[model samples]
Target: MTTKMREEIDEIPAAAARLLDTQTDLIRDCANALKKADPKTVVTIARGSSDHAAYFLKYAVELQLGLPVASLGPSLASIYEAPLKLGHAAAFAVSQSGASPDIVAMARGARAGGATTISLVNTIASPLAETADFAVDIMAGPEIAVAATKSFVNSIVAGLAIIAAWSEDKALVQAVDALPEHLQSALALDWSALLEPLREAESLYMLGRGPALAIAAEAALKCKETCELHAEAYSSAEVLHGPVSIVGRDFPVVAFAARDRAEASVAQTISKLAAGNAACFITSDKATGGEKLPFIATGHPITDALALIVPYYGFIESLSRARGFNPDKPVALKKVTETQ
Candidate 1:
C-alpha cells in the first residue's frame, strides 16, 4: 500500500490551496502584462484537457475582453496551423507541466512573429515557460499522481486570474478568489445524486458546449483516469452530429448550459434528448433564464464556470473505491506525458 497510491483526494484540497497561495505574483504579472496589451486576437496551444481549457479561456477572454480566441491544437501547433496573423496580439500555450514540445515551438513561432507569448504551467521552470514573454505558474505543486488531480483545478483558477488581469475586473476576481472557500462548502453537498448514476452505468458521456465544454471534457478525463470508466466529452453540437444515434434510455448525457448565445442551442439539444427519453443531467447558473432541463444551479457566470468542475472530485474518487480501482495510480499514465 503505497502512500502515493492511496492519498490523492486527501492531498487535493491542500495542494489547491498551495497553488492559489503561490500564484499571487504570477497572476499580478500576467494581469499586468495583459493590462496594456492592445491585443488584436488571442490564440492558445494545448493538448488533452488543456485543449478544453483553451476553449473555455477563448470564450471567457472574448466575453470579458472582447477578443477573438482560437485553439492551436497540438497537431496543428507544430505543422498545420498557419502563421498567426495577429502581429501585436497575445498567444498563450497552456500545459500542466509546460512539456509538449510542439506548443513550445508554437509559442516560439508566435514570439518570432512579434506576438506576446505567455506560458501557463504548474511548474515554474518548464520548457513551455522558457520561450514566453510571460508565464503564469499554476503552482498546484508536485502532482505526484499522473492523472492531474490538483493541477487541473488550479489551472482553471490561474485562467480566471488571467481573465481578471486582462479585463482588470475586480468583481470577477473577488468572485473567483472566493471560490476555494466555496469549493470546500461545495464538497460538503450530498454528491450521491450526481455519483449514483455514474456508479451504476457501464458508460457515461459528459457533454457541454461553448465555454463549459472544456469543463465537461476535463470531468470526463478525470473519470476515465480515476474510475476506469468509459467516459467521453464532446460539444453539444458535435454530440448531436453522431453520438445521438447511440442514445437510448440507458446512456446519460450530462450537459452544461452556459450564459452566452450558445446556451439556447445547448438547451434546445437537452430538450430534444429529454423528449426522446434520454437521461440528461443539466447544470447551469441562473444566467440561462431557467432552462427546462433538470437543474443543478451554480453561482455567477465566471464562478459558475469554475464551479462546474467541483462535483467530480468526490464522484470519481468514490467510484474508484466502489469498483476497487486505485484512482490515484492510473495504469501506465505519468504526470508529464512527453512527446515530440
Candidate 2:
C-alpha cells in the first residue's frame, strides 16, 4: 500500500494545477493590493514546512522585486504581545492548517499594524484567512499525511503566482502557468542513488544557494521528520566556513543547484567536497565533480529550484520506509501544531 505521503507527493502537480485554475483571480486581487500598498519591505509568518515555504518566498521576493523580505517570529504577538509597526510593509502569512494560534495572532497583528496582509492557506475558512486583507486558498485538497507534501508545494505555488502578477513579469507568469507540467516531469525523476549513502548515515548536509537554499532547508527538515535522520542545510558558501571540517570520506552531501546565477557557485562547492572524498551529489549539469541527480528545469530560476523538491519528497518517503519508519506518522509530531 502506498503511504499517504507518497500519495500526496504524487498529487503535487494536480494540486498546483487546481490552484492556478481556481485561484488566479484571488491571487491577482492580492497582487493588486500589494501594488497599491507599494510597501518598502515584506514580512512573512509561518512555522515548520510552512516556514520553509516562507523562506523560499523571501528569496523570490528579494530576487524578483528587489524588496527585502523578513520572517517574523510568531512569538512576537502570542507571547510578548509586542505591537508591530508594519505600516510601510506587506505581510504574507503562509499555513496549511491556518489555525495555529501564534500564526493567526501574528496575521492579525500584521493587519492591525497597517500592513496589507495576505494569507496563502489550504483551509479557506481558517482564522488566518479571516484575518488577512486577502486570502488565497492554495487548493491542495485534503492532505492526510502529517508530513506536508502537496500543501507545501501549493503554498509556494500560490505565492509565486501572486509575485508573478504583482511584478507583471511576463516570463514569470508564463513559467508559473507551466508549473503543473514541469512538476509532473519532476515527479518522474529518480534519486535512488542517494539511498545507499543516506540509509545508515547518522547525519548529512544539504547545500544550495539563493532560493535553492530554502529547498535545501526543506529537504533537511524532511530527512529528520520522516527518515529520523540528522540533516543540516547550509548555503553552499556558508558550509565552507566551518562545517567543511566535519566532512570526511564518504560523508553524504546533497547539493540542490538550480539553473540560476548561483548554480556555478553551488557546483563549485560540491565539486570541492567531492574531491575531498565526500559522497557528494548535485542536481546540476554544470557540476564537474559529484554524481549528478536528475532535476527538471522549469524555464525560470525560482521554479527550477522549486521543482527539486518533488523528487526529493519521493526519495525521502522511500528512505523513511527503508529506515523502518512510517513517513505518515513521524514520532512526536502532529498534523497541526496549534502552539500558543
What is the TM-score of each predicted model, taking all chains together? 0.84, 0.99
RMSD of 2: 0.7
Report the C-alpha displacement of residue 313, candidate 2, in angstroms. Answer: 0.4
What lDDT tens digits, residue by residue, belong to model 1 across residues 1-340? Answer: 5445235544555655675677788777777776777888888888766776776788778878888887765555476755656586788888888877887878877887777788878777888888888888777667676666566667777787778867888777776667677666555544555566667677877777766887788888877777778888888788888888887677777776655566667777777876777777666432232223332334456556556565556556677767777766778576677655
**Deviation in Å, model 2, residue 39 alpha carbon:** 0.5
Displacement of residue 150 (Cα, Å) in model 2 is: 0.5
Go through the candidates in order and give each one's C-alpha lDDT: 0.70, 0.95
With a 3 Å backbone cut-off (N, CA, C), the pairs that clash in candidate 1 are none
lDDT of 2 at 330: 92
- Runs in model 2 deviating more than 4 A are none
Q: Choose the strongest candidate by lDDT.
A: 2
Misplaced by over 4 Å in model 1 are 1-20, 75-86, 194-196, 257-268, 284-298
